[model samples]
Target: MKKVVAISIFLIVGLASVQAQKTAKMEFKSETIDYGDIKKGSDGLRVFEVKNVGDAPLIIEDVKSSCGCTVPTKPEEPILPGETGKIEVKYDTNRVGPIRKTVTVYSNSSEPVKALKIKGTVIDRESGS
Candidate 1:
């Protein structure tokens, strides 16, 4: 009687709470961006494509680069479910050497923190190699 009624109410509430909780999922087209080989002082901009596959809005909290030579920019607005966003990374092309940097992304997705990699080589214009 009373026990059965209380059990039923509890189950209903639990189910409703579960249904109200929505999560956001982040999916990247590719986790790594390869700059390839290019001459020094060339274009150093690249974009990382991200998609929100879950039912909730994806909010990017912050984006940090591993070094000062690398700059990463995150989207300002929230990405709704089933939508796409972009993170732009710019490396210092003036530096002649190998390009190996890590960019960390913080967001309200299932995986809150993600690490992206950029790799390539920068050739010296004077050397032409």
Candidate 2:
């Protein structure tokens, strides 16, 4: 009975460790962005901060936007452990009304793909009275 109990506890701890290892070590400050409100025909900028919290280095391969109206920029080099990086997002408000965009990031860490989202409402300019 004692041996069985010890074996069970070992298995449980091992499983927990494995599960934690499978989880992505990379993290982001804010996964989503809310522009809140803006005027039409305007442009906006946002920066997403990322940090490496795992033992391995964090390498961002690329960043892609959902549409041409949105642009994304990121660091060119790899971020060492406990280092920081940035993802710059630009939105062009040509069309009016609410807007939701996504920026996909590819990396060389445990979680190779990371997604960042942005949402906001655009108010059209009032016409001359």
Candidate 3:
């Protein structure tokens, strides 16, 4: 009976530790990109730097964009602790006026999911100049 109780406690503690380790912890330099002004019909690219601050390896599953006008690219391999990765986003200013977009990142870290945003105002060359 004593052995059974001790085993159960050990198992519980072990499981808790494993669960904590599975959680992801990461950091991003900037969560939002502010493109003050962009000319209409122009294209621009922004890169967001990510770092792993957890004990376990960080894996980025995928990156998604809110609209077809924006494209996102993420790392294909696992990012070990203390390592850095990049999230590349491309914005196509096909339409005029103010624009706000979002990029969602799915990863195996503690947060599992995160979002980054970009905002700017687009103006025609005649208007901007």
Candidate 4:
């Protein structure tokens, strides 16, 4: 009888934990952003949409890129549940050639660690004939 009671309690706690996770979740519209083809020294800004699809507020602790060439800015305020937010990424288009970078996102959500990607090519300006 004691073993049965203990097992029942464990099951209840496990179920509660699962439900708690769903209460603080982050859902991003797209994890990867493609810049396509761009010219060197051209605009290098993009936005990634994210939503807090949970019951708790989403707090973004930090945002970082793979290298200095790529910079990502996180939202300054917490995002309430059912609300959307943006993460801005800027790539140094001056560096010509293929562009492949990753952005790391840290937030107080069920999925605390997230990775975003930026990819494309930066074509060099034509030289004077």
Among these predicted structures, which one has the highest TM-score? 1
Local distance difference test, candidate 3: 0.87
| Clash pairs, model 1 backbone | none
What is residue 113's positional error in candidate 4, in angstroms?
A: 0.4
Regions of model 2 farther than 4 Å from truth:
1-24, 127-129
The 10-residue segment with the lowest total lDDT in model 3: 17-26
Error of 2 at 36 (Å): 0.6
On residues 73-103, what C-alpha lDDT tens digit does candidate 2 reach at each position? 9889878888888999999877677879899
TM-score of 1: 0.89
Q: Write the per-residue lDDT of candidate 4 for residues 1-129, one digit (tens) a residue.
A: 999999999999999998776556889999999998888899999999999998989999999999999989999999999999999999999998898999999998888999999999999889411
lDDT of each: 0.95, 0.84, 0.87, 0.91
Candidate 4 stretches greater than 4 Å from native: 1-22, 127-129
Clashing pairs in 4: none
lDDT of 1 by residue, 11-119 (tens): 9999999977888999999999998897898999999999999999999999999999999999999999999999999999999889999999999998999999999
Model 3 CA deviation exceeding 4 Å by range: 1-22
Alpha-carbon TM-score of each model against the true structure: 0.89, 0.75, 0.82, 0.81
| Per-candidate clashes, comma-separated | 0, 0, 2, 0
Off by over 4 Å in 1: 1-12
